[model samples]
Target: MARALQACLDGEVDEVTAQRVAVHGEGCRRCGVEITVYREIKNSLARQEVPDEAAMARLRAFGADLLTTGPAEAGDEAARLGGT
Candidate 1:
């Protein structure tokens, strides 16, 4: 039940799995509450605004640049931060 819960909620599980989860949820109070809470969370997140794509792209580029920095440059950066 635990393993199939997420897939069932995502509608990625097969019919048999869906049935199993539904049946289990019916009998298990905790599973029913978990399903309800997850559905609420998913719905709440869906209603939130999407981020700015251009800003997101720039952030990704900044992260990529940090990753590609050489060891010498990282040491230089550390020295700039007053670290030996």
Candidate 2:
């Protein structure tokens, strides 16, 4: 059921499978809630904006810096970048 829900949300299931999931969700309260939550999360993610080129460039530079730095320096850099 969880697999079906995830497949439906991800649009990976075919029409027949999707119809079956929809019908099952209609009859099962738990499935209905699961579908609603998945749909909301999917829609929310879909509405997110992509980062700009400058932001991507900065991330690439940070990654390169981390790769070149020693472990201790990497930890400090990660802390400076607000990463754990």
Candidate 3:
């Protein structure tokens, strides 16, 4: 049942399966709650904004700095920060 709900939410189910789940949800309290929760989660995710190009560029540069740093230097920095 949970798998059916998840498959419906993920759009992996066929139209007939979706219709069956919708009908089942109407009669089943637990399925109704699951459907409502999934709907809210989907709505919230759809409302999220992506990072802009400048923010992405800065993040990439920061990642590059971390990658370019020598292992010994990283170990020294980690040790300074009380990390083993």
Candidate with the greatest lDDT versus the true structure: 3
Q: Write the per-residue lDDT of candidate 2 for residues 6-58, one digit (tens) a residue.
A: 98879899999999999999999999999999998888777655536687799
In the range 1-84, model 1's lDDT, one tens digit per residue, is: 665798899999999988889888889999988888888998877765564677789999988888888577899999999996
Which 10-residue window of candidate 1 scores lowest in summed lDDT? 44-53
Worst 10 residues of 3 by lDDT: 44-53
Per-model TM against the reference: 0.52, 0.56, 0.56
**What would the per-residue lDDT of candidate 3 be over residues 1-84, giving only the tens digit for each residue?**
899899998899999999999999999999999999999998777765553667779989988888888676889999999996
The lDDT per prediction is 0.84, 0.87, 0.88
Would you list the rank order by lDDT, best first? Answer: 3, 2, 1
Per-candidate total of colliding backbone pairs: 0, 0, 0
